[model samples]
Target: MLNYGILSTASICARYIAGVRESKNGFVYGIASRNLENAKQFAKKHNIEHYYGSYSECIEDENIDIIYIPTMNAIHYRWAKYALECHKHVIVEKPFVLLKEQAIELFELSKKNHCFLMEAQKSVFLPTTLKLKELLDTKIIGDIKYINLSAGFPGRFPEGHWMTDHASGGGALYGSCTYTVEFLSFLFDEPSYQYDAHFIKGKGSADDVVHFTLLFNDIIVSSVISMCCALKNEAIFYGTKGYIVVKNFWKSNGLDVHIDGNMTHFDFPYTSEFVYENNHIQECIEKGLTESPVMNKEKTIYAVKIVEDLYKQM
Candidate 1:
C-alpha cells in the first residue's frame, strides 16, 4: 500500500483524506501543518496515523511513499520540488504552477529523481469525461466547429484571501479557466493555438474576470471565467452534424448530446471526483509509472501554456 502524506490543512485536504479512505491501495498516513495543534486535530478527525508540524518533516518521513499537495497555487512548485527531492511521488492540485517554466522544471526534477508526479485534475479522470472522449473519437458529434464554455462564481472571499492575491496566483485564469483549457486540449491535439483575452481586475493585481477566444486547428472556442460573477457554468460543443451541451462541465456530472434534433442525456451519480484521481495515483505507483497517462506531462504543460499565454495577452 502507498502511504500518503498531506502537507497542509487546507479545505481541499479534507476531501483528499476522504478519497484516500476510499482507495484500498492507499491510506492517509500522516498530515502536517505549521500549527502542530491543527495538524493533530485534523489527523485525529480523519483517523490519520501520524501528524507533524512542518512540511519538511512530513516529506522527509521515509514511511510516506506519496505526498498530496493541495496548498496555495503559488507554492505548488516549491512543495512539489521539495517532495521530489526527497524521492517521494507527488500529486499536486491544478493550476500546477504560476508559470509554465515552473511546470517544466518540476517535471524535469521528477524525472531526475525517478519519482511519480501528477496533477490532481479530477475532470480528466471522471468517467463522464472519458465517455465524452470516446463519443468524440467515434464521431458521435461529427466534425467539430466551435466550442463555448464558461465557468465562474460570484466573488465572496474575504480580503487577503489567496484567491484574490495575484502574487499568490489568484485570478479567474488560474482559479477556474484550467478546466476550460484542459477540455480544449483534451478535445484537440494541436498545441499550436492563437487566443485573444480581456481581463477585469478586482481589488488585487489578479483579474477577477477573464474572457477569451481561441482558435485550435480551425475550431473556434470562446470562454468566460470570473470570480466576480456567476456564469452558465457550461460547455457547448458545436459540430457540423450535431452538438453536445454539458452543464457544469468541470464537475463531470452530466451532459446532453443533440444529433439530428434528438436529445440524449447522460448523468454521473458519483459524488466525489477525487476518488477516481486517488485510484489513478495508486495504480500508477503500483505499475512503476512516473507519470499518469490520463493527465500526462505533455498535456499538462499544454494546458499551463494556454493559461500563461492568456495572462500575457491580458
Candidate 2:
C-alpha cells in the first residue's frame, strides 16, 4: 500500500484524508504543521501514525511514499520543490503554482528524481466529467458553437485570511478561475486560438472577479469566476442542434442535456469525489510512471500559461 504524508493541517487536509481512506491502494500515514501542537493534534484526531512539527521532517520520513501539499498558493512551489528534491512522489493542490516557470521547473525536477508528480485536479477524473466528455465526443449536442461556464461563492474569508491576501496568491483568479481554465483544457485539447481576459479587484490587491473568453476554432468559450457573490455555478455547451447544462460543473455528479426540446438528466453518484483522483495516483506509482498521461505536464503547463497571461494583464 502507498503511504501518504500530508503537509498541512488546513481544513482541506481533513477532507483529503477522508478521501484517501476511501482509496483502495493508499492511506494517510503522517501529517505535519508549522506548529508542533497543531501537528500532534491533527495526527491524533485523524489517527495518523506519524506527526511532524516541520514539513521537511515529514518529507524525510522513510515510510512516506508520497507527499501531498495543500498549503497556501504562494508556498506551494517551495514545498513541492523540496519534496521532489527528497525523491518523494508529490501531489499538489490546484493552482499548482503561481507562475508557469515554477511548474516547468518542478516537472523537470520530478523527472530528474525519478519520482511521480501531479496536480490535484479531481474534476477530470470524475465519472460524471468523463461521461460528459464521452457524450460531447458522440455529438449528442451536434456541432459545438459556443460554451459558457461560471463558478462563484460568496466571499467570507476572515480578516487576514490567505484568501484575501494577494501576496499569498489569494483571489478568484487563482482560487477559482484556474478550475474553469483547466477544465476546458481537459474537455478540449490545448486551445490554439486567441483569448482575452478582464479582472475586477476588490478590497484586496488580488482579483475578486474575472471574465475570460477563448476561441476554439470556430467555437467561442466564455467564462466568469467571482468570489464576491454567488453565481449560478453552471456550465452550458451551446451547439448547432441543442445544449448541455452541467450544474456545479467542477464537482458535479450529474448533468442535463437538451435536444429537440427534450431534456435528459444523468447522474453519477459518489461518496467521495477525491477517491478517483487518489486511485489514479496509486495506479501511476505502481506502474513506476513519473507523470500522469491524462493530466500530463503539457496540459498543466498550457493551463498555467493561460492563467499566467491573464495575471500579466492584471
Candidate 3:
C-alpha cells in the first residue's frame, strides 16, 4: 500500500485522508501539526499510525511516500519544497502558492528531486466537471458565447483571522475563486483574461469580490466571485444552442445541461471523490509517472498565476 503523510491537521486533509483510508492501495500513515494534540486527535480519529508535533518530523518518516500539504496559502511553497527535499511526493491544497515565482521554484524542485507534485483542485475531478469537458470539446453547447461562475460563503472569522488578514493570504478570491479560475482555464484551454473588473472588500485585507472576463478560443467568459455576500455558487456556460448550469460548483450536486428545449439533470452522489484523487497518486507511483494528468504542475502553475494576479490587483 502507498503510505501518505499529511503535513497539516487542517480540515482539507480530513477529506483526502478519509479517501485514502478507503482506497485499496492507499493509506494515511501519519499527520503532523503545530499543536501536538491536534495531530494526535486527527491521527486517532482517522485510525492513523503516527502523529508528529512538527512537519519536519512527518517528512522525515521514511515509511511515508506521499505528503499532503493543506496549511495556510502563504506557506505552500515552503512546505512543498521541504517535502520534495525529503524525497517525498506532495499534493498541495489549491491556490497553490502566493506567487508564480514560488510555484516555478516548487515545480523545479519537484523535477530535480524526481518526486511527484500536484494541486488538490477538486472541481476537475468531479463527475459533472468531467462531463463538462466532453461537452465543451464536442461543442455540445454550440458556439460558446460566455461563461459565468461565482462562489462564496459567510463565516464568523474573528479579528486576526487569516481570512481577513493580508499576510495569511486571506481572501475570498484565493480560498474560493481559485477553483472557478482553474476549471475555466482547464475547460477552455488557458483562456486569456482580456477584460477585468472587481469589487474590493470594505473590511478584509484581501479581495472579497472579483469580476473578470476571459476570452477563450472563440468565446467570451465572464465571472464574478464574492466572499462578503451571501452564498451564491454556479457555473453557467452560455452558447449559441444552449447552456449548462452547474448550481453547486464545489460539491457533488444536481447540475443541468440544457440543449434547445430539452434539459438533462445530473444527479451526483456525494461520496469521497477526494479519495479518487489519492488513487491517482498511487497509480502514478506504481507506474513511475512523476505527475498526475488531472492535476499537473502546468495546471497548478496556471492556477497560481491567476491567484497571484488577483492578489496583485487587490
TM-scores for all predictions: 0.94, 0.97, 0.93
Tens-digit lDDT track of model 3 for 10-89: 76778877778767698778899998999899888878789999999999999999998888887888898989999998
lDDT-based ranking? 2, 1, 3
Evaluate model 1: give its TM-score.
Answer: 0.94
Q: What is the lDDT of candidate 3?
A: 0.78
Q: Among these predicted structures, which one has the highest TM-score?
A: 2
Which RMSD values do the candidates have, in order?
1.6, 1.2, 1.9
Q: Candidate 3: lDDT of 54?
A: 93
Global lDDT scores for all candidate models: 0.85, 0.89, 0.78
Q: Which of the two, 1 or 3, has more TM-score? A: 1
- Candidate 3 Cα errors over 4 Å, as ranges: none
Q: What is the lDDT of residue 116 in candidate 1?
A: 96
Specify the poorest-scoring 10-residue window by lDDT in model 1: 183-192
Over 1-314, each residue of candidate 2 has an lDDT whose tens digit, in order, gives 99999999998898889889999999799999999899999998889879999999999999999999999999999999999999999999988998899999999999999999999998888998898889888998899999999988775665567887788988888887667877877887656647799999878787788899988779898999888878899999998889999888888899999999999999999888889999999999999999999888887777778878888898
Error of 1 at 30 (Å): 1.4
